[model samples]
Target: MSLHSLDVRQTALTLLRSGVRNAEVARKLNVPAGTIGYWKHMDRAKRGECPGRGSHDCPRCDGVPLDHAAYAYLLGLYLGDGHISHYSGHRTLTLMITLDDHWPGIQDEAEAALRSVFPTRGTCRVRVKGAHNIKVYSKHLPCLFPQHGPGRKHERLIALAPWQQEIVDEHPWSFVRGLIHSDGCRITNWTVRKGKRYEYPRYWFTNVSDDIRALFTDTLDRLGVAWTNCTRYGKPYNVSIARKESVALMDAHVGPKY
Candidate 1:
């Protein structure tokens, strides 16, 4: 009855290859749905049909290049709201990014970013959860996003690897755009002085992880973007760029979200 047994794996693969759905296979074998997916993924890897970056000897192996803008954007997404998980007994990696459904065109931008990083892979699968969130999933996630580790992102030492750092250094604006698009927002703030109404636009990014906060702030500094730090009481740490010129600069690079 063990799901890890070779018999179970072979049966699951056969069922999957024969057009059986993952949920059905899991239900019939009394195994977890994830287990079925893991087996199917492994089988595809063996057949050299795994998506994203392909096999080492693949003719299309020109997989996602290192130090590319798309990779930087994906890294930002990962640091912001993405998650990575490894399938048991397989080399499969699942990368997921969940975004608020209310953000208009953010979902399309996210899909574009993922596709740019995994050109060989088809469109990522999207699932609606709860009432306000959209989740996207792809199997080749780990190849581009290697920041996966134990515990919450803030609790760990979240420094970038050398190669990633190099890419970010060369393409700071894209990195910043990705980070802001995920964890930050551009909006107008209203105030009243002596009964006179005034409105100003700004950019804000917040995160609970100190290391990630530092990374974000440092990148901003390198880009010569001025910002200030504050706290959200019981919530996350905050970094805001409210200067008129700074907001204009960010708009030039990050633009306004559709």
Candidate 2:
């Protein structure tokens, strides 16, 4: 066909679908640069009109990451407290387990286990339709809920940085206590009576860290810090940053020397 007889829209669609540059199309067609985009976008919305898989709209939303609002919204929907939509692509309500990820690739198992553990009334099925690799938060999810399938031989502690190791070795309780918030919720938070003892962050009553034996020596020995022990020289039942008025309490206390 003669160049004058060519359909720009048809030509644009063909080129755009192949991931060709619009400028190249414009240079060939001798038309405005944005005309290809305008035609392609308009064509995509009409059913059966899109050029091909790589066309302007065919995988348009594919591989685009979800934003925080969408993520949080999906989470809320799982607990039955937010909007649920059949047409919406995000359907599963997933909470991660707290262990480091070495689990076999059985997201389906985890999804099925979630449905079994926490039943829902929705018609849509819970499924591992996707795999999300978040940097930190999601890494520990499977650890807290180990029933995704079968757990392995043991749970390994994460290797700490040098400073963290010093803290871990010396004030192990403090190290463990500090991790509750960063990791998932702790077991003590789930206990009934023990959970009610504190009034601040509910997490204060929950998580437990790996206990290091050096905590009694390094933590209590620090001058100007006051901690209480229920039994003399035993691990503390209650420990705190000493109040200014209570600084005097440390004077008479004998720390676990050596």
Local distance difference test, each candidate: 0.73, 0.33
Q: What TM value does model 1 have?
A: 0.71
Overall local distance difference test of candidate 2: 0.33
- Per-candidate TM-scores read 0.71, 0.20
What are the RMSDs of all candidates, in order?
8.4, 19.2
Top candidate, metric TM-score? 1
- Candidate 2 on 1-258: residue-level lDDT in tens? 123334666887788778888789878887667566545544543322322233121112222222222222222122111111112232222344221233333223323433433332112233243422211112112222222222121132323235333433544333332222122121222234655653221211111212221232243355334434333355333233234343333223311111
Q: Could you give candidate 1's per-residue lDDT for residues 55-142 as a string of tens digits?
A: 5422223433543787677678779988766655534556677777776577777777766666555555455763122333455443
